[model samples]
Every structure is written in structure tokens, then in C-alpha cells.
Target: MQNFKAMVLLQIIISIFLFLSQASSQGIGDKSNVPEYAWLAGNWSGNGFGGTSEESWSLPSPDGTMMGMYRHLDSMGNITFYEFLLLDETGIRLKHFRPDLIGWETKEDFVTFEMVRYNGKIIELKGLIFKRKSENEMEILLKLRKGDVVKTEVFTMKKINKLK
Candidate 1:
């Protein structure tokens, strides 16, 4: 009888603790605290010299962030390049992390950037402005110490059909 009572008490205490923990996680907070990257929620496709590539991304919450990854491989089935979405509080960012799996760790040319503007056409981040052409294309133009150059890339994605 005593053992049964002790087990019941323990179960009740555990249930209460679990309920409180879940409730705390649902508390209201600033939108930034949760992630404001809701623009990338969709399926996307693009092509380049490496070959055709596709990616998909969606956020768990309607007001949360979205992310995606893509792979473009060579004829031999070896990945020649890869790209992924980068969504931060500042803005939506994209990164092509690796050109090839071979010795990629030695390459420090990669950078971390965030979005500063979300006007749907021009996104400014880290003092650089990216112009958007259509829903899946963007170009970055900036002045360099050596000269001025413009880098352009195209992305295609559709918001998860199930989500409105």
C-alpha cells in the first residue's frame, strides 16, 4: 500500500513539472527573440555550370524563419558545390559554403552576412546592397579597393504548399 502511494505521488509531481515546463516555453516574447525570417518558406530550383539544383525551406512557425540547402554534383556524382540559406534577425542571407569537399576547410574566403533591408527589391546588409530581380534572383554590387564588381545569383523557392 505504501509503495503504491509513493509511486502515485511521484507521478503527480512529474506531471506537474512537465506542464509548467511546456507553459514556460509558450510565453509571449519579442518577435526578434523567435526569428523573423519568414520569407524563405518554399521550394526552389536553379541551374549553373555545375548543373541543375533544387532546394526547399520552411519555418515551423508562421512568424519564424526558414532555411534550405542544395547540392550540385558533377557527372561522376561527386558534389561540386553546395549552397544553403542563412536567416538571422537582421535579414535573409545565403551562403555557398563549399566549392568542393576537397580541402574546403582551408578556404577562408567565405563570409557571414545578414539582411538589413526587406523592401523585396533592395536588401542592404553589412553596408552592401543587394538588388532583387523577380522573386528568386538577386545581385550584389559593391566597390572594392581594387575595383568595382557585381556578383549575381538566382534562387527559386515556393512556400510550403500546406502553409498559407
Candidate 2:
């Protein structure tokens, strides 16, 4: 019985070690071949997060940077929150703000999501994935973390000429 218990403890320890290693490596990836996000450039909106979610992306600029912005609204069309997104050689960094443009984090802090997979149509970031369903349609999956809990939000958005 003693030997069996010891073996079980050893196995648990090994499992935990492996899990920690993988978790720590989540946002680290090869940045040399970050593809241009021309497919994602446009205005996108859909139902998400208890209301409507909108995202606007800019084409790759001559300075080699892509910019985006996001906004979430309530059913009544009241602004709930906003986010500024940027993609560059480093990674995708985003900052959250309230409707009044008050930041949610410290001035120097922003959430960074690293690119993990890209195969033309599908681009997977550390905790976010963009799947191009068609030229005018896209599926976005975002992993939101709070404390020890994690939730995934799926948004299906279509390209629009402007935000509605």
C-alpha cells in the first residue's frame, strides 16, 4: 500500500510539472513570419457578450503595423466597453477602456496575445483565433480569463462598410 501511494504521488507531481511548463509557454511563438492580416481588414460586427460586438481593422501600413479597435454594446445600443488593438513585430497588444475612454489597466500595461498558428484562412493567437469563413464573414474565438476561471466567447461577424 505504501509503495502504491508513493507511485501515485510521483505521477501527480510529473503531471503538474508538465502542465505548468505548457501554461507558461502559451504566449511564446515564432515571430519571424507573422503574416499580413489583409483578410481581417474591414469592419466586423456580430452578436457577442450579451450584446453586439464590433471590430474595425486597418490594412497593413507601410510602417508594418496593423491597427484595430473593438467595442461592445448592450441591446439598447449603449456602449459597454472598448479596446484598442495593435499588431506589430512583437505581438498583438490590446488595451481595454471604458466608454468614456478610461483605461482598465495601468498606463504601461496591455494584454499581449502571441500568434501560434497561421494557415492563410485561420490565424490562432495565444488565447484568440480568427477563422475566415468567407471573404465577408469571419469567426472569432476569444479566451477570457478571470481569476481561476476561463471562458471562451465566439463571435460571428460580417464585413460592413461602416459601424452600425
Candidate 3:
């Protein structure tokens, strides 16, 4: 009877351990486990290859959607180009707009990227990634491929203003 009781207790312990391991593994792949990207909501400025660049991001909503705008300027402070970004249920989408407000993409089609990986601080899109170095600093890496040539642009931004 003593041996049988000991075996039963051991089985129970093994079962609990297996259950916990499975739960943790599942959480790693669950989207709900991702942290809210609300920290990105604010005004940011930085220098890029073109010149000074500014970006504004909106707070993430309860439904999981956030909007952002980016503008690049030349040394003379003239707006060179602008980009609109959105994060939604489908994924992250980006579109370029001219100074005249003309969109580079058609109404039916636009460039989109999926979140390949996202930790609390680093978010990796398909060809782009944003790493939040600290409360006041962030880095954006964009990879562009044309034919067989690939180029990467890095933008380091500093937080200029916090969202109200």
C-alpha cells in the first residue's frame, strides 16, 4: 500500500509539470501575449540620410489598431516625402504620400507587412524592424530590395513629446 501511494504521488507531480510546460509553450505563440505598443504613441524626431525626420504615432486602441505618420525633410526644411503607417488585426501596413497628399498606392492595393516577431521592446516586421532602446530612444531599420540589390536604411529617433 505504501509503494502504491508513492507511485500515485509521483504521477501527479509529473502531470502537473507537463501541464505547466505546455501552457507556457502555447503562450509564446499566442498573439494575446504581446504587449501593448502604447509606448510608441508620441512625437519623435531624428536625423536620417535625407535630413531631419519627424514621426507621430497614435495610441493603440482596444480593438488593436494604431496609426502613425512620418515625414522627411531636406536640409532646407522642405518636405521630401511622407509615409502613413497602420497597425491592425491584419498586420502592419505602410503607404507613401506626396506633399500634395497623393497616395503612392491604389485604393485597392497597398504594401503590407506581417509581424514576424515582437518582444516587449523590439518589433520585427517582414522587412522592417523597430527596436525601442529606451524611454527616449528608438531605432528603425528598413530593408529594401530591388531585383538582386538590397539596401538597408537605419533611422534612430528620440522622443520629442509624450502623448497627452
- What C-alpha lDDT values do all the predictions have? 0.53, 0.82, 0.83
List, in order, the clash count of every candidate structure. 7, 0, 0
In terms of lDDT, which candidate is strongest? 3
Off by over 4 Å in 3: 1-34
lDDT of 1 by residue, 1-116 (tens): 99999999999999999999976766544344344334344554455444555556655353355565657656566667676655555654555755754433335543446666
Could you tell me how far off, in angstroms, the CA of residue 108 lies in candidate 2 after the best superposition?
0.5
Candidate 2, residues 48-151, lDDT tens digits: the string is 99899999988656444779999999999999999999976455899999999999989999999997766659878889988999878999999998999999
Ranking of candidates on TM-score, top first: 3, 2, 1
Q: How close is every model to the real structure, measured as TM-score?
A: 0.45, 0.73, 0.74
lDDT of each residue in 1-164, candidate 3, tens digit only? 99999999999999999999988865635556434565678999998866998999886664557899999999899988899999864568889888888988987777898878765687788888889999989998989898999998899999999975
- TM accuracy, model 3: 0.74
What residue pairs clash in candidate 1, if any at all? 41-159, 42-158, 42-159, 43-157, 43-158, 44-156, 44-157
Worst 10 residues of 1 by lDDT: 155-164
